[model samples]
Target: MLWLRSIIYYFLTALIALAISAIAGTVWGVAFALCVVSIACLFHIFNLHRLHRWLENPQVDNVPGSFMLWQEVFDQIYAEVRKQKKAKERLAGTLDRFLSAAEALPDGVVILDDNDRIEWCNPASCEHLSLNRKLDMGQPITHLLRYPSLRDYLKQQDFSHPVIIRITRPAEQTLSAQIVPFDSTRKLLLSRDITQLERVQTVHRDFVANVSHELRTPLTVVGGFIETMIDMPSSDAATRETHLQLMYEQTQRMQRLVEDLLTLSKLESGAQVREEEVDIPQLMQLLRTEANGLSQGRHTVEIGRLDRPRLIGNHDELHSALGNLVSNAIRYTPPGGTITIGWEKRDDTACFTCRDTGIGIAPEHIPRLTERFYRVDRGRSRNTGGTGLGLAIVKHILHRHQAQMIITSDLGKGSEFAVKFPQARVIE
Candidate 1:
């Protein structure tokens, strides 16, 4: 419709010029028509120049103003430009949001271009790979990480499995890195700190092996004794009795191991311990009695003053934890060694301390004392009739009670194991 209007207007103007020229001659009419056409073409060329100039440096606030056909054309172009500008703004906002979300992720994220050059990376990626986001952009990822395992993994282009890297500098840490190919040639490098996960897996493997090994020892002994008795049925009564006793002891040892393992499983299964107000003095007295019995008058087992008489926690769990400490004291202490069990209020905290004049532990062994089946002296630990899960159980119980176990020891000197309960759990 706009084009039709424009064409009719031009035709009318040319016809008017010809009618005016008719007063002169045919030659004059043709000349006037040529002049009018020339003027119209020049005006159109001027408008086209304005449009071109505006297009070169277009601004929404500075839209070109024209009349008639040129006006309509400029308005149409401006409207389309505005729509495209809004679309671009929306796309930019979406991109920003995506980048923000990626930045907040705990796992490291690195974006790579088609050439495997670092395009962008999140803060976590910088920390995980020791790459400077500002300085390392456009650098090859392999050059930055420099880990042979990572380089090989990337070079292979087999991203089905993530590669694990153990970083030794600064601090020991483990990272699992994988490459995800996207946009054909581009890639997303994802990395996660798997130190704790790796440690847990290692612990799980050790636990399984230890459990198997522990069970096998007793089973082997029991099986041997049973076979001996079966084959020597005609042997003397005393010999038979000794074999039976040995078999019974082995079975008992196995039972204890199984029970401790079960206890640890229960504790780890997230079952909440029953909370109750336990009489600390009574518990200590019982532990003292048990310690004395275990000691068999070999050590001086003393029950000291209990400053905090009551504690809020699971009685059975507490008993098990404290008993383990006292028993450990008795087991390690030699004859005439002194063992002291007591509770003291230190500020708002209550501490149940067991100090023993035993063959103390090495500093290196103290940190791993609570680990399951971690024995400082394997032979002595076995001879002491420990399931090797006692300290592990103590740790779990104390953790459940919102408490901590603090150990102080020196080689060849006595050791002190203290269970520190928070004020919320202590009733003075």
Candidate 2:
């Protein structure tokens, strides 16, 4: 329609020129028509120049205006330019949001070009791979990472699994890195910090091994005694009774071990604990009696500084935790040694302290005492009939009750285990 309008306007001009030629002398009328045509051509040329100038630095507000059909031409061009500008803005906004999300992610993200060169990366990516965002842009990834395993991984076309690599750029870290091809020419290099995950896996493996080792000894002893008794069916009653007694002890040890394992599992499961006021003085009396029975009148279990202040926690769990501590003191202390149990307010925290005059722990062993099945002396621990989960159980129970245990010992002198409950948990 616009082209047709332009053609019609030129046709009308021609008709008017012919009309002028017929009315006046051919020479004068022809000259007048040429002059009019020349003026019209100049006006059209000026508008065209304005349109070209506006197009060079196009903006909606500065669109060229014209008097004739050129006005429609300029208006259409302006509308098209405005529509494109809006679309571009929308795309720009989307890109900005995508970058922001990537930046906020904890996992590292790097965009790689076809040449395996870094194009863009988030802060986490820079920290994981030790890459400088400004300096490493367009740098080949292989050169910066410099790990043989990573190089081998990149060489493979398939990325079904991530490559684990240890890096020491900023600190010791284990990174799991994988490449995902998004386009034919570009890829995403993603990385995650698996240091903590790896540690947990290692701990899990060690825990299983320790549990198996601990259970195997008692099982072997029980099996051996059963086999001996079965082979000697004609033996005397006293002999058979001894064999049966040893079997009973081994079975008892296994039972205790299994029970402790179950208790530790429940503590670690983050189950809700039953909360009640724990009468500390009454609980201490119970512990002293249990300790004397375990001691067999060997060590003297005495109560000292028995404060009346109680605690807010699960009574059964507190009893178990405190009982474990007292029993440990009895087992480690020699005959005639005095084990003192105390409940006292030290500053704002209520403390339950058990001090024993026994073969004390070395400084180095104190740090790892709470680890599962960690025994300072394996032979002595076994002879004492310890499950080796007592302290570990104590640690977990204390944690649940928002308490802290402090240990102080001098080698060969004695050790003191003090559990301090938080002020909030203390019922003064």
Candidate 3:
């Protein structure tokens, strides 16, 4: 419409020029019309130049202003420019949000270009691959993580399976990495820290093997005693009685093992224990008596002062946990060793501690003491009539009661097993 108006104005100007030429001289009128047309063209050219300059470096405040057709043209171009700027801003915002979400993820994320160059990576990826995010940009992925397995996996583009890499630098860690191809050339490399998962799997395998071995020992003894009784049916009564007694002991051992296994299972299954106010003084007295009975004069069992008399937790579970600790102290302590049971509050935390002058655990073995069937000395553990699940049971019970078992020991000196209940569970 602006162009049509401009064209109409030019036609009218020509008509006026023709009328002037008819009255005055054609040369003067025609020159005047040419001058007017030249001036209009120059004005349009000047506006176009300004628009071009603004397009080269667009700023919101520097939009060109013009008149007539040129004005319309400048306005249209400026509006389109503003629309494009908004679209770009929206796209940038979305990209920022996507990057933020990726950064927040626990798993490592790396983006690679067609050349396998590092385009972007999250913090977790940096830790997993040990890559410097600032310096490693545009560096080849293979250059940073130079493991043969990762290089081969990327080269083959076989993303069907994730590759596990064990890293020894910085720390011993296991990472599972997989690459996914997108947009033909771009790839998303994802990695997860699987160290804990691997440890759990190893523990599972050990538990199964240990269970089989533990069950087999008692079953073998029972089987041997039964065979002896059958073979010596015609022998003297004294021999038969000895065979029967041996068989009963083996059966009892088997029973104890099965019971411990069941208890561990129940605890692991997250079964909630009954909460009751337990008398710590009474509990300690009972444990002292039981410990003395188990010690059979071999160890000096003593019940110390109980600072917190009542505890809000499962009485039975507490009994079992403290009993296991006391029993362990007695079993490991040699003759005339002192074993003390007591409760004390340290900084609002109630602790039920069993300290003994027994043969203390080695530093390295203490970490794995709570594992099922884990024993520092298998022969000694068996001779002591331990099922090897006592500590494990104690650990789970403490967990249920919102408590923790802290074991401190010095090799050949003594060990102290302290069950520290949280402040909330301690009743004064």
Candidate 4:
């Protein structure tokens, strides 16, 4: 373009000079030809100026007149700018919400980069693991977690199986942690407090041991009695009566143990925890009838002002729970000792209180009486044909129904066993 402009400038200058020379010579044809050439050169310069302006030469002028002519192009660029700004804000808001949710979670969460470095963590993870931004940021995951399982898991690269670690951190906290491999080459650590679950397991193990030990003694006694009877001569009638009576009593004791065990098994298995309504008054009446049969008109049962207590539970199962308490009263209370069965409502709940004026449980023994096959006095319990699983079954039944069991006792006065159920839990 420069070369062309230079040639045009030289041609225009030569033509203007030639036109002046022709006009000075007064030659009509030559002068007219020169004048037309000069006019054409001026027009070419004007056309070149317009062509340069149309090419949008940025070096030409900062403010060109095309802003009005190209208004649509300017508007599109403005719209695109606004769209990009809004998109940036939206992305920022989304990220904020994501971080907020992560912080709100109760469990700990840590995100790692491909290099196994701590990249991000929520507040819970921070508190659980004492994460220091200055020390932990861009640091190794091993440095923070400090657990063998995590180290081994990282070493093996076996993401298919998550490494679960039980971590004890600040504030006497016990946590069960699981490292889950998910999207993005990072590991997620989730943890929950399992102290209660651990405690319950320990209690269950102790109960099993105690029950085994308790049942073993009675079994050994029964076996010895049988062996001695076999060793005795068959013709000894006087000895036979005494041995036979002892064996019968042992057999009855064994039967009670087996029955109590079955009752406990049924209650624990929860074959009857489903929503069911029980007429509380009717259930007490039934328990009374069973107690009468056990007493054989020996003990007098004094029932309290029995209000028709309507509760939501299994009638037969509740009957069995109450029956155990009432029968225990009859067996422990002397033939003349009186037993009282009371039904009432406490708070927003219905309670069945069995108060027996029998040999009450001691304070120290009351706590463990609900343990399977646990007896306060083994010899006395055996003499009374007690299985020791009675209170345990009662406790399990109350547990299944989300009810509470309260046992109050004194040395020689009496004992009261009350099963309380919240009203909201009651069924029609």
On lDDT, the candidate that comes out on top is 2
Candidate 2 residue lDDT tens string, 69-117: 7878888888998899999999999999999999999999999999999
Off by over 4 Å in 3: 1-40, 144-146, 224-241, 296-299, 335-337, 345-347
Clashes of each: 0, 0, 0, 0
Q: For every model shown, what is its TM-score relative to the native structure?
A: 0.87, 0.88, 0.84, 0.57
Instruction: Kindly provide the TM-score of model 1 when superposed on the true structure, using C-alpha atoms.
Output: 0.87
Off by over 4 Å in 1: 1-44, 67-69, 141-145, 157-159
**Per-residue accuracy of model 1 over 386-411 as CA lDDT, tens digit each:** 98999999999899999989999977
Worst 10 residues of 1 by lDDT: 301-310
| Worst ten in a row by lDDT for model 3 | 302-311
Please report, as a residue range, the 10-residue window in candidate 2 with the lowest summed lDDT: 24-33
Regions of candidate 4 where Cα sits further than 4 Å from its true position: 1-192, 233-235, 272-286, 292-300, 309-313, 331-336, 344-350, 358-371, 374-383, 398-404, 410-412, 420-428
Residue pairs with backbone atoms closer than 3 Å in model 2 (clashes): none
lDDT of 1: 0.90
Q: In terms of TM-score, how similar is model 3 to the real structure?
A: 0.84
lDDT at 171 for candidate 4? 45
Q: Which of the predicted structures, 1 or 3, would earn the higher TM-score when compared with the native? A: 1
Candidate 3 lDDT tens digits, 1-428: 99999999999999989988998989978988998899988987788788788879988667888778988887887788789889999999999999999999999999999999999999999888888999999999998875788888999977999999988877889999999888888999999999999999999999899888988988898888788778867989888888788878888888999999999999899987679899998888899889889988888898776785589988888899889988888888989999998898889788888899988999999999998888999999998889999989999888888898888998889998888889898877
